[model samples]
Target: MKKNIFLVLMGILSVVSHVCAQSLPQETSQSIGIIEFVLKNSKYEDTKCDIHSCQMKSKDGGVSLTLTHATMKQDKEEDLHYLLKINVQGTLFSTKVEVRYRNDPSKQTMKTGKRSDEVDSSYKTEHRVLRSWIQFIKDSTTSKS
Candidate 1:
């Protein structure tokens, strides 16, 4: 009798688990094609953009966008270059965005900093701002299309 009851309970548990799994909402996935199309049609104010391939398979063939901003120093007419790269990957049913920020100033201007080469430094607040900005760009571009 105990053996029969144990088998019955196991059967019920399996059925319930299957039902729950099927009822759970699945994440909406976007295709790489759509992502590429949206990126091509997107535009940013006061920024120059360069789009290229990142070649990450898991991210459904990654796409990279380098947004460069040049600001002129107040005292000197030197240009300070800031580059923020947004790496986008589309998986089977999800999209991922990674942001990389860097400061690329002229050798003369960069002398004031610790390193002469491009500096890769960003704060949490900056990341939040960039994430929102990227979201805006994505939304605006999709809406226009």
Candidate 2:
């Protein structure tokens, strides 16, 4: 039936994606930290920065990201963002992770009658470009050393 064929195609696609992901692409760093990723990959529009978040407009379709939060921590060399420190196995690894941002609070995209917490992660949009940068650095460094 049609359902059987669809399932087979899904299975093959999943396998292909998995195999492709094993060898992650490498990312080059500008200043050895998340500062570069944040500044470069974020919207090219003027960013109105605040204590905890920065407002930016995505160049793709001019979508605005308000109160944006990111996954990467600011490196000591940079004064633009915060640094995320993690203790793993009693050792510390300062990682350059990508960021996630909450949509403009004024705009509601979820279903009605559901509270923000009840829906899911408030940070809805993923900065794919920035994320790729983080992944590239992590893979290149960790895999070698």
Candidate 3:
């Protein structure tokens, strides 16, 4: 009778585990694809964007965005917090950019800060503010250029 009871308990445990696994949150492939597309198509004016790296497949549902001496990582689903570190020219400015995603209008912006030469030792530094936004532009109508 004890052996039968043990087998029954094991079966119940296995079933519960399977159910939990099925209900666990999973990152969709579409999100990764969108990020890759944007990164590949992004361009910086005269300055070249090098050493591009992305971590959209994070286990904790966090995504990392980096370019050269700049890095930004955020996990809105897990925690409503973001961290940004950027080094432009010869100046280093680190600040948090407010991120909002809702009602079909998503926006992100960073406050101004005085730049320093320690950020990058190759060029002059000055106070500068950087703002970036991403929007889905629908190809409504196309004409020959």
Structural similarity to truth (TM-score) of each candidate = 0.21, 0.22, 0.20
Q: Please, what are the lDDT tens digits per residue for candidate 1 over residues 64-133?
A: 4543444445223434333334455445333443332333321111111132222122323223344444
> Which ranking of candidates, highest TM-score first?
2, 1, 3
- What is the C-alpha RMSD, rounded to one decimal, of candidate 3? 18.7
Q: Native-vs-model 2 lDDT?
A: 0.35
Off by over 4 Å in 2: 1-43, 58-61, 70-145
| Candidate 3 clashes between residue pairs 3 or more apart in a chain or in different chains | 90-120, 92-119
Query: Tens digit of lDDT per residue, candidate 3, span 55-133?
Result: 1212222323332222244343423233233222212322322222222222222222432211111111111111222
Ranking by lDDT: 1, 2, 3
Which numbered prediction scores highest in lDDT against the true structure? 1
Error of 1 at 130 (Å): 1.3
lDDT of 1: 0.38
Clashing residue pairs for model 2: 70-99, 71-99, 74-82
- TM-score of model 3 vs. true structure: 0.20
Candidate 3 residue 70 C-alpha distance from true site, Å? 11
